[model samples]
Target: MTDATLTQTGREPRSAGALIGRRLLRWGLYALLCLFALYYLLPLFVMLTTSLKSLEEIRTGSLVALPREVTFDAWGKAWSGACTGIQCEGLRPFFWNSVMMAVPGVLLSTLIGALNGYIFAQWRFRGANLFFAFLLFGCFIPFQVVLLPMARMLGIFGLAGTIPGLIFVHTIYGLGFTTLFFRNYYVTIPHELVRAAKIDGAGFFRIFWSIFLPLSLPIAVVTIIWQFTQIWNDFLFGVSFSSAGSQPITVALNNIVNSTTGVKEYNVDMAAAIIAGLPTLFVYIVAGKYFIRGLTAGSVKG
Candidate 1:
């Protein structure tokens, strides 16, 4: 079009070149993203293929090849029949152990943290910052640093080499982070609510139950998801605190996968790994929206 018509329409032939370049750049970014996605996803593809393949196919074929014949045999074995040690029974019990450990661990930790966060965020006691700082201090200390002390304490409590010991360890370790999450999230809550509750003769638990707890749902979800995943996947605490029968899924999975015996069951190992991971994956998928909201809530400007 002529310059007059171009000006009238807010269009230019020269601008078409710029538009084409923009399109090319956008496509280039998309291509880069796709490449990265494939790079990260390649292992999952391999694991699925390997899990479905027979031992012979895995040994003879490419690692990334589609299974010659799909089989649920490995999945079944991984779930109910694979040997972790002298025990030929599969991951079922250990999975339950994880469930048992994770459920109470998440609940108790999050509950105490919610209370602690309320005390830290809303209750302005003297030395509160110092106490909160002490709590934060726990988060920085590595588990290995406290491992000996924790082990000794568990032993003293007669909880060593038991599932409860693992639960206790996870709850204590997790309290630091969960408290932090709720504290930061609660900081964003307006003080007017707390003041109004006090004026209405509400006590600490009353204010928390009535005014804060409902508002804390987003952060509670984040805390539960975080604690659940961490406790479920923890290998160190499980290995140190749990014996053969009491071991969590992680330790059991290790024993099963690394059992130096007659045959290396790659298919079974892959299937077991998937089974071990499914809970955390499912949690992330289901509550992921609340997770994002919880993370962003603390950062919002009043």
Candidate 2:
């Protein structure tokens, strides 16, 4: 056989060894990742299994064991039959309340943030940096710090304990973050677009609506996901700002979990917890990739 042919046909021992080593390393990394995934998912697994089990089975069987007989009675009870405090209407109303609060809050905050971001990025005015810095500072302020002033404002506006009040609270609190995200994203956009739009007789809103808004989808997704997650999962504001009738799911979940009037139905609690968490989880599962893309899109320029 020719030397070239022999070299090609017979793999080098060192190369073969390296190939085996690489395969082993890759498999090892995969196994490690799977292990970590399972570890992180353990709670969710437990919750699902427990929710499917009857209360009797939950007590008799292992905490992580699969249900002996799967049933969604707990889910049904959690959705509409269970009590949240004095109300026997389950988490249904509170879930809808959160939806109402979060939807409007996310929209209003994102819209206002887009406008603020446009202004800061394209039309720099006096004290722009100072004002931007203040907004950034507001992002880090503790929720407790603003509770008193916000409560007072809500009272004055006759918005206290209402869904709109909660919406207003979330919008105000989330503005700083939404503004930061959109501003950073907008600054990466070509300034010439704005300048050219102005030279062509486009006004502030006109340029924004025509040029910037179209390109803002990525950042808008990021901002929406962020603001929605914050507003949906917010217990502090939900508990503080809302009354019994207007309380968000988080508050209702707390009430259900802590209710002392009846049997400690572990299955029901698990189901309710899952129900409360489903929205944010679903949002991430559906749009998580876009979030990463959006974050990186702005990161290059600012």
The clash count of every prediction, one per candidate, is 0, 0
lDDT of each: 0.89, 0.89
Residue-wise C-alpha lDDT for candidate 2, range 166-201, written one tens digit per residue: 999999888899999889888888888888888999
- Candidate number with greatest TM-score: 1
Candidate 1, clashing residue pairs? none
Per-residue lDDT of 146 in model 1: 84
Worst 10 residues of 2 by lDDT: 1-10
- C-alpha TM-score for every candidate: 0.93, 0.91
| Tens digit of per-residue lDDT, candidate 1, span 1-302 | 11121122345637778878866766676677778888999999999999999999998999999998999999999999998878989999999999989999999999999999988988889999999999999889877788889989999999998888888999999999999998988887788878988899999999999878878888999999999998999988888888887899999999999873887999999999999999999999999999998877763343
Question: What's the lDDT for candidate 2?
Answer: 0.89
- The stretch of ten residues in a row with the least summed lDDT in candidate 1 is 1-10
User: What CA RMSD would candidate 2 show?
Assistant: 6.3
